[model samples]
Target chain A: MAARHTRNIVDRPIWKSKGEASTVSFSAFAFLFSELIQYSQTKVKSTAELENRLEVAGGEIGRRLLELLTYREKAPKRKTRLLDLLKFVHTTVWPYMFGKTADSLEQANAADDEYMISDVNLALTKYISVPRDMGSFNPGALAAGIVKGILDAAGFPARVSTHYVDVPGLSKPQTTILMKFEPSVMQREARLEPRAT
Target chain B: MALIYSLYIINKSGGLIFHKDFAPISRVDLNDSLRLASIWHSLNAISVQLSPVPSCTGIELLEAETFNLHSFQSVTGTKFVLVVDPRASSVPAFLQRVYQLYTDYVLKNPFYEVEMPIRCELFDAHIEAAVQKYPMMS
Candidate 1:
């Protein structure tokens, strides 16, 4: 039998539009985010506290975006494994942000619960250079927070942190986001593990 | 393709970061655009993000003789910059489309950082087509 040919299905519109592309100044978003960080910095005292706030901020984004995108993929919701979900975030989500997906992903040869998603070029530090004065406060780290927020909200509880790894020419240090799953996540994995073996 | 008159992305501290033009257009001073972007980065950053909500800053739009510049400020404060043909009638829509991409792709991508320059090729492709419809200057 042939597939259904409903106009609604055939003409389903994507997020794309026919209008001309919009434009803005890079400087516009930079200083604004800088202040957001600065103001958010005031809400906390400890480094962890500030970082936590940033993560919370990203969490809000994660939730809203998750709902929005998931709604688009509502029908024929494909069943996803833990790993598959991770890939979805990488291929689908990452590109939405940087106009590309993560550079690569790796499994820890030594650790079972460890997975690595590395993007040689994380967009945050691409243009705005983080000054040295802000000791231990990595602007790229917030990107990490954004990642974690999405993962957590997506029910893939993992510890994701952004690191400024060395890249040859791309001054914006390539960020290798290390995602470590907690014991509970592993336990859930074990329970959810289909007994294929 | 001819020079599309790409826009420049400068970090808050001022640096040449990302550049791309959606349409083929006039000559562009890469160095000058980058310099200006960096210099203005500080001011634009402060102003744009505090819009209807406090987290929507970033390159809003760049419109002029050749191409338009637009930016999307992510929740975590990453920026996505786009350069489009100035003559494109859908420039505003293109920016919105990029924002949609940002929300759907970038914001959702566990790997993407907030308020950072956009590096997602998918978003770029969309930008390319959105602005690609512009007529080339003779």
Candidate 2:
């Protein structure tokens, strides 16, 4: 049976494939993404629908990337704390996806479960142009979904929103992603901290 | 000996995202290339349906008198099609290398907008060198 299986190729799991960090052409990616947006435009009824489609597509990629990155790191244990997971995403995951580290991470003082990750030039939307009429349309919606997907996989259910912020000296607009964890996640964190101490 | 002539990548939605000519062939008009891409996409789907086996993968190769067409589809339905001299035997290997380049340079590039016309210089340079190095093309 082993011989028979070995005789046939192309039957391995995706994770079993190599995990080396590599880079591809920017124009190729731009072309492919342009098609994704155009395709979504045709299938959806409204701008919200298009953004949702892009989000869904991004979430799918994020779910797989979460697994791929974790496996690549070969860390002895998985991250559990909310802060640790967020840090991992900001430092490690962001660079892996965008070729650079995120600009900043901030904890919102007003809310217990609120956090923010900012990128001076969000990679996904670097070259995207939104029509003036579609004021709410932001390509970063896909990035937001990716963040939500990663957080959800880490057991911290969260909602993520993207906003643009212009810094005085920067050529490109900065992007901030606001992440709000569900109440249960905060409650779980509160419950878990006592036991370790 | 086999020589590569051109390559085209069609997205799942029947859109042409990448098109490159390795050796100079007659230039295809932009609109015609789009039409050809959609036709290939439809034919790929139709070929799968016509397969006797339900598990049959779509068309992999088409041979003609002077040239041959080789194709590979990613899990996400992005199709890579290559036109090469009919004698080519390493088409799969070439396709895999191009796919690797796509994942590395194109997918990983921060400035890349998915599904748009590919304009990455590195990808072009790498593929150009690869094509030129082929036994016949060189």
Candidate 3:
């Protein structure tokens, strides 16, 4: 048995080559997420607390996913600039997890440190119907957590929150993830801008 | 036509988490169902010990003069037991669909605690719909 096991390992390595795109079924994720929200509901008294719990859970996934995805890239390069990092999350991370790129990435006009990532219809919220009593509860908090986790891990510590904005023509409200970078992070980005150019 | 008399879900620790009778008139009382669950749990364990094979799962199927008992044990050690008429077909398939419903409704429900009795309205509704798909003996 031991000899055969050794022979098998030599012939076929366990790990798959890069860019294979490991994926889980949407229904499977939906089921697991539903359970997560339900379990979180039992522990929190307020919707804010529930969102915080979900964000924390999502943060863990984001941190790990960042590491895994970078390793999977053909040319793995650590994102150092703020724009590069945000674009990575927008183009790479969102599609990797949700099967589609985020709808838009926009800089907040009022503040240099603030930015927004919006989705017309968030995949996570597609099946979730927030209870009436839990007014304005957003499961998108998990996605915000993911963004925060990725940014923090990538050395761009920021505050991220999920919001629902009503669009005039759309039946469903769009989800916008707002991010506010720390003062220190903005200072670092300013210093690196000359070299980045 | 298949006659599925009842369905029961037993948790890993051998406690009855859910039970439903589909016959026109209920045959087993709550107490009787509880007793039967524990009895089956013990019997399953005993069968495993008695088996000469290394990894014998307790009882998969048991045929009697009147009814047939079909059991499917998931990887988590939870057992889904179905009691139906002797001529029942595709018992395993029916149980598989029932297990999927358990995961979706009972497990996914936020208010539900693991190993506790299932009382989810959505679960009950879906189970009824799934059972209806199978033509009854009538």
Most DockQ-accurate candidate: 3
Top TM-score prediction, candidate number: 3
Q: Tens digit of lDDT per residue, candidate 3, span A90-185?
A: 998998888889999999999999999999989887656564577888889999999999988988999999999998998678999999999999
Alpha-carbon RMSD to native, per candidate: 14.3, 12.3, 8.5
Question: After aligning candidate 2 to the native by TM-score, how far in Å is the CA of A29 from where it should be?
Answer: 1.1
Tell me the tens digit of each residue's lDDT in model 2 across A160-182: 87777778998566888889999
- Candidate 2 chain A minimal-lDDT segment of 10 residues: A12-21
List the candidates' TM-scores in order: 0.49, 0.53, 0.57
Q: What DockQ would you assign to candidate 2?
A: 0.03
Q: Which ten residues in a row have the lowest lDDT in candidate 3 chain A?
A: A1-10
Deviation in angstroms for A112 in model 3? 1.0
Off by over 4 Å in 3: A1-19, A195-197, B1-138
lDDT of 3 by residue, B1-138 (tens): 448889999988889999988876558888889999999988999999999988999899999998999999988889999999998899999999999988876766555678888877668778888888887776
Worst 10 residues of 2 chain B by lDDT: B104-113
**lDDT tens per residue, model 2, B31-138:** 998999999999999999999888777989999998899999998898999998877769999999889888766765444566777776557767787777777843
- Name the regions of candidate 1 deviating beyond 4 angstroms: A1-27, A74-80, A167-172, A194-197, B1-138
Ranking by TM-score: 3, 2, 1
Best lDDT goes to which candidate? 3
Candidate 1: residue A26 Cα off by (Å): 4.5
| lDDT of model number 2 | 0.80
Q: What is the lDDT of candidate 3?
A: 0.86
TM-score, candidate 2, chain B alone: 0.92
